[model samples]
Target: MKVSTRPLWRKATLFKGVVVTLASLAALTVQASPAAADDVYGKPVGGAILVKYNELDRETGPLGCPTSIELDNPDGVGKRQEFAGGTIYWSAASNAHPVWGTIGGKWGALGYEGGKLGYPVDDERTDPDGAGKRQQFQGGTVYWHPTLSNGAHPVWGRIGELWASYGWEGGVFGYPTSDEGWEEPYQSMTQSFSSGGLTLFWSPGKNDETSWCKQECVGYSGAAGTDWFKETRVETYVGTDQVKVRAIPTRNGFNNARTDFHGAWNQVWSMAPYPKGINQVEHRSLYEQFACHAAWAEERLPGDWNTGPTWDLESWLPSIGMEKAIDPVEARKHKCNWT
Candidate 1:
């Protein structure tokens, strides 16, 4: 065995050298051959853009085929590539993000990366509320909903902060219907939401304020008294609307009423919905309870009883003595009598 060891060792070294040479040739072939390179729609696409394109399933996915090679962004800080479906933007700070469909269209209208939104920081994703899609950018966020005819809209700045406070798309405001704009008379920034029914306004040195369509008055009742009386009315509508109660009183009878209730109670209270869910039956029942309470209060007030005595509904919450008639949760937990 020892006599043949030299020949065997030389043979093994020669085999290894051949393998290395072949590997080098293979690598060179791959580098030089356009056929072996990464190409989308006959266009060479590489780097981060290519990686993202692949992640999105290449030509088979929503991104379709590449229309342009990877190019430097106008800002010079990032790169972008166009595809049949959308564009992939890459930046050192934001990595790679794909914007497509209505969301992409909106971002483009806002001036692409050069707009106030800057580079997109995340891909378009289903909103947690499950009603729409949303994408985050360096400066703001864009949202899209199928039911909205205006397509996608951007939300940011103070108005964005306010929307976020209420729960974003899922909140009371729902999705934004309009982009932020300036109000010349008030010198404030304003944005519309809830299908243009609600508008949020922000001015210098002032907190955000909102105005929405006045809710339809669903229920009404009145109580009259010779010297003093109060009438309570409940107003609201279905679908993410505010519930308000108005207490109208005769000036001569309710002079002792709370100062807040001048001629009538102008304070407006808002609640998500009755019974803590979106049940129409329960909501209607809740409204009926409010009307019942108004009638009961009107009947209970003391006076000559010519028409009825107007009473402050807020003061009668604890002693209204109608817990059995109304759901304890609705009556006590929500303080439905006042709010």
Candidate 2:
């Protein structure tokens, strides 16, 4: 085979064009109104920025200011910026996950509205979601990072185990107990996430002995300097008349190992969000439970509602309308245009 040497700038330009073209096409496909015939060709090509990030966890903490990259020849107006993507990893943060593709154009920086897209928090607005309410996570695949090479595990189990399966089972840890406090015991849980590094800990019981307790079911010690100890806690949140949630702890660490139950620390499972229809109490409870859990977790371990001091979970946030945007990149890659 013969190879021709091409200038680095020429190659970069070529690669950028292909990506921008594909992204523009994707945007056209999803646009509510028909795209202009010459929209992609009419304008002078410009540059656009594609931001990449890992799913937020209690570990990675805040990714900081919105990632901004420039691609050429973008089109559209929202918050007056180009395209915006949100946390989309849970399923494959450490594996070959989906990627999102967006067309290059000029518009205000994308931000998160109540549910709508807004600029990054660091930009201006302090509110979490911002003004928009559609609450849609846009951008087609082409953004997810492949799983890490070598041996690396996730700190938490699959989102399903935390939300769908109800509780943990198998040969996973039971409950850890100590002289200070304790963790509840139920079924063992053993799961291997696509990410192959961080260890995941869970309790696996919804309504066990206590609403929240240490791993070994122990109580606070009346000692001095170092009285507090790690424990397990299982709590549930009921929403309107259609939602309920339970969280437990199995073990906690960036790496895997035999957990002591009560001593090992880390959030295990988080129940899936359910609809309340017309009930506000349940809705409130749902929010309360998650907030309380976030708060309690802040005290026991190292975390926060927005970002964690000890852990990072922004990458794995379980927003409602996420799956729809799961793997645009993969979807487009294997999609048969004619078929």
Candidate 3:
């Protein structure tokens, strides 16, 4: 979309050299917009990656179990690799059943990883989406913790690290974050199951559970059996509600290289550098979707949500009249500043 950040209104004074104050510059540093998602297909903000993907995997019934593939952290700063690998399996059904997989498997560890959000081992039942006080998913069970990491892990991690590491770029080995707060998704597996056996499913949120609707979930071997290499074309939209897909890769570096489609991590990194940049700098998630926040270089353009003096992010909402006073009485009372 045409999201804007506060702009830098620099004026050259004949008597001074770049006479900007630390306070004004500091004001410009504030983030005034909603957080961005790091899906597989989208572009990055000035500082962090904007990861986007169409859909990881669609949920099928328990029989439609998926497998977890291990991922290596490229940053080389995370916890042990054994605990770092991602996994896939059929989550416990909304109902209880005998345990079938190794408890140490990726899903199992997170299932029992006790925390405020950790699923209660005492509960015998689970919902398809892993909601409720004691619901279970393919990876583990769900419990509500104030932090994202407290619930069953779609992949292994403390909630904050998971959200921060995999911003608007490709994850080291997993799916990117989404706009749904802690409700971000990793991937979904589709497979087949029989009544005699139990199936497992995994999702970032209990509200995200879906039935395969008879869609077939196959094993890796089964996926291999299909003509996966065959060319397939599907119609889809790219970019956000404001930016046009055709206008992406803007000639002036404004909305340039913009693609509404899910993007690759490497590509996202190119647009928004890591660390101090959007794709890499780690910050508290702006909103519940928990996407990484932004940190733009001096050379780049900012989004409408920026808190800089030149751009009053609150007043820049596209629907609002452009001339409206940025510091309205309500905004001023709340300490809202353009910078």
Candidate 4:
């Protein structure tokens, strides 16, 4: 759309019954919002500018300075003005609203008006539940949940698409607990939602748009340097108090196999019991090669906390009929949404 370069943008429709509303608003005698300081090539006017200025408390509007003059979109779709703090967007159907801050930043990253989310249908504000912040875009809404380490993060795109399908905040996922984080192993980004009960993971692959898992899953396979890396994470306990002590060897790459424990040079696993129990797990050790042997593994002793080169865990694969290590391993992907 074509946006006017002028400071004042006049629309035939806004001149209609809006005059009565503007006059009534003027009767309030509230302080008109002051014009922005930075992009001040022109002085602020009185008529339509005053109405918009008054709509937002002068000097107190969410958007501070008028970075760009109010103008009609080239497509003649709506009205908009850029500001220091945010932008005030107006549509006859949706009215005028401010899109700013974290939500606005994310909207910009998604391409603003040119992005999938066409326009700001409404302002950036809290949702009905008051759990987190919300902003409406043309295609969809962007939501921000407070982060423990950082202030907050944004969740958008296909993840947002899936979130909408799950019933938004009211869905089983509930409000987001953390912003998105990139999983180097999976070549994906995931965000915690539903108070960590459910996690939404989004992959770059067009087909693997989004997937929800309880705990982070390095996954069963991926190419080297992709999402592949051997790990034995105790994902979750049987319940709340019990440490069921579950351990499973996961395929680190797409070429991972039962016989080949280490696919790429990028592989290792660790176990600690020293000061707590007394054990050590390090590669190039006896245990690292023979871990598959239940008897050999159980009989072995753990070393000091920082000890290394413990036991041999090799050839255990072929002993168990696993000869080729380049074959595909089973894919047993788990879910974070499971009860």
Candidate 5:
């Protein structure tokens, strides 16, 4: 949901170079818009936006003739123009800088003008840590970080929203070190940030209470396992719970990675305190299915999973072979890890 923030957020935390005056922000309409989303493209636009378009390096930059007219900022006093490949934002202080590519695409997806992120405060720039590129917006930033499955993608969406609640770049998560990505089997928009990382997943496979559906939750944190070599694992969050498959590399066993798929964690937990209640049966089934999935990933990927690039399960499954279903009782003999 779109939330208004303290005026201090704009003038205080971020870069000093692009701060717009409070008086200017006060003069603009509340969430103003000059062009609708369905309007025609490549139409002529005038004023500050046109000046920025004229300055665009048409020869190399991913820009085209103005696609939308200079529109007014709904949250503040800013002007922006859309192009085929990028956008230009203008303010008295920040001038008009260009934002394009992955960052621009994400900006467009967030409703451009009407979305929660208000307006672009600055152009897209490479983050200092080199995790990836990002652009500042009124509410929060959109991050395009590198992933083991997909090279670099717009990984921050809802997780970014959760991050904002935690305190944005300053919160516990810090700036995103990796973009939120999906690992076929994982089903979460998993993203790693400066501090640590976050895993988020939504399940139509089961009811809400049993899973971390409505609330912002932190799932699992990988740690050293008993069977030796640093462990690598993936959990399938479904129904109401999750089932993890682990690769336990020991000194004796070079790449000893195995999971019975039934582990202790596979058992269904009770749903949350709610009115509608959660589906305990579906929740149990989801994790059981994950155990079979764990066996699949371990059988195929084998060895140290981290040694090479990560693959998306949704796509990788079909490429390898049709995934086989497993029964929780049969797999319990060789189940996964437990606390």
Candidate 6:
């Protein structure tokens, strides 16, 4: 046994050297392979985009699989990657957000993150109505609904703010039907919506104004006991000035009788109470009283007033010399009910 001790030592050293070599090779192979080599889709996805992709459930989720490696955004500061279902955009400020479907198409048309909309801050989400979808971006929001033939539309800037005031998709506007557009005549920015043929307009140095047509004429006979009249109402607002013209049928029960009209009808125009310092007396004598007088004068006429025709109240108010009666500045202060 003593004679063979040196041979045994050599064998032991050889075995240790082989084990170390194998260990080194194993580490090298691991280093050479992709970190995210799980590549069930055969494409390499890594970095923040990869993390988002995984969050979305990768190949099994709605995003499907990565169709392309992460690419540089035009802005150079951001990165994006395309997938079968959508694209994920990543920026240092916005982190990562997935935009897809109609909303994605609209955003792309608006120039992706390069256009006015900038980067998306949140993922695409279902609207409160549940049927529509909306996604928030740095500059604005894009909305989509299956029922809309025009696909998706964006609401942003001052007009966007006004839409938000009216309650967004859940409000009177429903969903935007068109993107922001220019109205050469008014020299204003405009956007249309799905509800009541409503459109919002914004001009330089002015608050938002809205114009909408009533789909049907509704009858109203305020507390004054005046003859019931059907009004085809169309409202147009400019700054704080609101002009509501009711085109009433002259052939109602008061055909032969006449009433003295001092101003607009005695009706509660605002659901909310008037602000402080503005009492009901001033609201009636100044705004509604004059508006009512104008309507009464219009009713006396024989042609369209008898037929329940659609007329412009703002334009008519001036023709009757009652325009001064509608003090837009005072009207803003009072919040008069021009019924």
TM-score of each: 0.55, 0.17, 0.19, 0.39, 0.35, 0.62
Candidate 3's TM-score reads 0.19
lDDT for position 158 in model 4: 54
List the candidate 3 regions with Cα displacement exceeding 4 Å.
1-104, 107-312, 315-321, 324-339
Candidate 2 residues lying further than 4 Å off, grouped into runs, are 1-78, 81-118, 121-143, 148-208, 213-339
lDDT of 6 by residue, 179-298 (tens): 878767445677767765556656552333442322211111112223433433333343434444443433542243224342113322211112223344434443444353344433
Which numbered prediction scores highest in TM-score against the true structure?
6
Across 78-182, the per-residue lDDT of candidate 1 in tens digits comes to 998888988899999999989888888899999999988999998888888676999999999999899852589998876686568667888756788888776
- Work out how many backbone clashes candidate 5 has: 11
Tens-digit lDDT track of model 5 for 1-339: 987776876656654534455545655543244432222254755555655555665424567656667777764777777777777877776577777876676666767646666567776777655666677776666665564213223434555554565565555545555544564444345666544333333223323534322333323323333343333333333332333333333432232222433441221111100111225543443344444434433333445443222221111121111122344454344232111
What are the per-residue Cα lDDT tens digits for candidate 4 across 1-339? 998875444565567669978888986555444433222336342333445556676446665656677777655877777677777666666666677777787777877676677777766677666657877766776777564213334557656655666667776456666666787754566666653245555554323434222332221111122243323221111122211122222222322423344442224333211011113322222233222221112213432211122221321122222221111231111110011
How would you encode candidate 2's per-residue C-alpha lDDT over 106-173 as one tens digit per residue?
A: 11123222112222222211122232111112321001112221221111223223422322211122
Cand. 5 Cα-lDDT: 0.47
Return the candidate ranking by lDDT, descending: 6, 1, 5, 4, 2, 3
Q: Rate the local accuracy (lDDT) of all candidates.
A: 0.60, 0.26, 0.23, 0.46, 0.47, 0.61
After TM-score superposition, the amount by which residue 138's alpha carbon in candidate 2 deviates from its true location, in angstroms, is 15
Worst 10 residues of 5 by lDDT: 267-276
Clashes of each: 14, 83, 69, 25, 11, 10
Of 1 and 5, the candidate ahead on TM-score is 1
As for model 1, its CA RMSD to the true structure in angstroms is: 12.7
Error of 1 at 250 (Å): 17
- Give lDDT for model 1: 0.60
C-alpha lDDT (0 to 100) for residue 249 of candidate 3:
20
